[model samples]
Target chain A: MAAQTKPVLHGYFRSSCSWRVRIAFALKGIEFEQVPVNLIKDGGQQLTEQYKALNPMQQVPAVEIDGITLSQSLAVIQYIDETRPGPRLLPGDPKARAQVRMISDLIASGVQPLQNLYVLQKIGAEKLQWAQHFIDRGFQALEPILKQTSGKYCVGDEISMADICLVPQVYNAERFKVDLRQYPTIKRLNKTLLEIEAFKVSHPSQQPDTPADLRA
Target chain B: MAAQTKPVLHGYFRSSCSWRVRIAFALKGIEFEQVPVNLIKDGGQQLTEQYKALNPMQQVPAVEIDGITLSQSLAVIQYIDETRPGPRLLPGDPKARAQVRMISDLIASGVQPLQNLYVLQKIGAEKLQWAQHFIDRGFQALEPILKQTSGKYCVGDEISMADICLVPQVYNAERFKVDLRQYPTIKRLNKTLLEIEAFKVSHPSQQPDTPADLRA
Candidate 1:
């Protein structure tokens, strides 16, 4: 067996993207240390020059592994799935893999960023309304696709990257007051997912940096 | 040799996501039939009941190939790269592949959706400013990473998916009036990318459906 290395993840408590990396680590059973970079404090610590140097994107959930730091939640997860001994986060067949990626990208690109903190801040007074609109648009598409793609998980009973992307985006949706009642498939899947050790332990409320009052 | 299937690409002339697929198809030497989905006509053709059934996301650049219709530009590109005999779009090494994905997702998730047509419309009076801000923010991160990751392309000398993503986004940045001079690496890479046949041919102005006045 290769030497075990504990990766260091630079992230915050409430960031959906950072929350994604946490779940992947838990699901894979890769023990790692978490360093909180409070996004809200000091006008967003992620926007600071030091954090920006660490991650040019200045985004939470940058992972330090094998002496290299990688940003982008999906990329960080992919690296962990690839280099570590973990449950495969992607599948074998070409088409199945594409389906997994399609679902993941739908949430990662199609939904999440549009309703993210930065974009929400720009929306000002109508932030909630804007978040709901984009979330609804995304979930409407995702529900039907998830119906076709999901079976106990986001992709056919196997916990894949799509599921990793799904849980946090669903958390964000609920935060913005988008009714998951409209997205039955997503709701069902999120319920099953939240029960899993990885998803449960990695929930924003359960994170190390989560405020005591916010802890559930 | 397998039977020649002229894959039909469902896209609009101006959709950056669609433009990404067009470049990938051209790069892979895939002969695809272009089906123009007029996003601006009839209150957006992509939102039609018929189109939504085809792609629940109602997004442009869904491709029909081998009797399967796939949506999401990155997913479609991955499908094409995987099943077809062509120059590879992602690298062989997992770390390298992760890097490519990081850059691609940066544009796909981090930048594009925030500045998408739907988001801009919702921004009302601040559309251009909003677009410029996100584009500039994304490009700032992208430029430095591209410097680390590029030789002739966004991820080494190979014209990977990152390059495919980069060109359309640079086009968007220019469209939004964001100064490319501020992102020297991106500007340089975009210049070189436009000179390539695949990217040049797939450009918005060169598309079959582009308005005569808009045509180059």
Candidate 2:
């Protein structure tokens, strides 16, 4: 679990999705080398021939383990939990696992996609507007789910995949200047997660590759 | 689980999302009343206050189960799978479950959100054009995963959540004039799933609530 022997994480410094996986690795005390892929610089280093070999989608946070490169942030992190020894990210039960996944999909699919750089770039100057629009809509749907599922973290006291999904989403939403005021359950749970160093240390602003202007 | 004692399902005749759940419920042989909610009438009957009370999001396929209503198409379906005793909708181990979920999320979150009615309305006439655009994007992402995961069904020989998710999305994509030649796996899988009566019976064209123009 020491820092030096960590597996390599090929990711963008400011990618919230990457941050989510980083947080999970941190929480599990799994050592990982942070290999930066600057998404915006030079029109995305992720799209280079070498990186594309790692991810066909040319997406970030693709991890290399046992010489096998895995894509998709959630899938990669779940693979880590499944293969590695540490605290389990997903719960043991089917229903609880479903709950963890529902939250993960909510953030990963619902909230995160709407604000992703590609999506933002697609919509043009209306990026900020679309970002807020989807964030609130996503959080609105997520708020009640959080209330029903959360205790201390996203689903009871012990951290699971749900918290891994939550913190990065809140971070991205704030980056887009979305008003998180409407979702109290989200706000409360996020505040609790913030207290954990695992969450803070994995934040995009704290990443070594983050640009000076974007640093928190 | 006779028809009379079963729960009620409020959905449109042609909403592929509803059709997917209907097929699931039918395969489980859990009877239910199909109360159609017209999506195009008066700007969507789902917007009505009574419907909103049943589902805050005011979307269809809301199930009134044991007097407690539930929303979100996937959540509703998962609840059914958990409570019912019939054939399981999702097959395989936790890893398989995650795979099925990833595929479902790829479509449900990744594809459906982009081609939503509200999204179409927001963007106007160019909407239909982008519908195929997003569907193609989704199917492209899905083909490889399904190819890797398939054994006859999405995760194996038995039909799982991946099948449920796939049927609807493919249905919509075909309806939008998207060519499925490149998505051979999805096309082959859809052809196989069609052999089952559960899926056949739930086709949007057969629904009482389906709009005449949209029906196949």
Please give the lDDT score at residue B153 for candidate 1: 84
Model number with the top lDDT: 1
DockQ of all predictions against the true structure, Cα-based:
0.82, 0.25
| Model 1 misplaced stretches (Cα beyond 4 Å) | A2-4
Q: Per-model C-alpha lDDT, please?
A: 0.89, 0.78
Question: DockQ (C-alpha) of model 2?
Answer: 0.25
True contacts kept of 1: 0.87
Residue A39 lDDT in model 1? 86
* Candidate 2 structure quality by residue, lDDT tens digits, A13-99: 778778878988998888788889989889889879888666555678777765555666776777778767888898876566666
lDDT of 1 by residue, B24-127 (tens): 99999989999899988888998889888889988887888877778999999988898888899999888889899999999999999888887787778989
For model 2 the local lDDT of residue B11 reads 87
Chain A, model 2: TM: 0.94
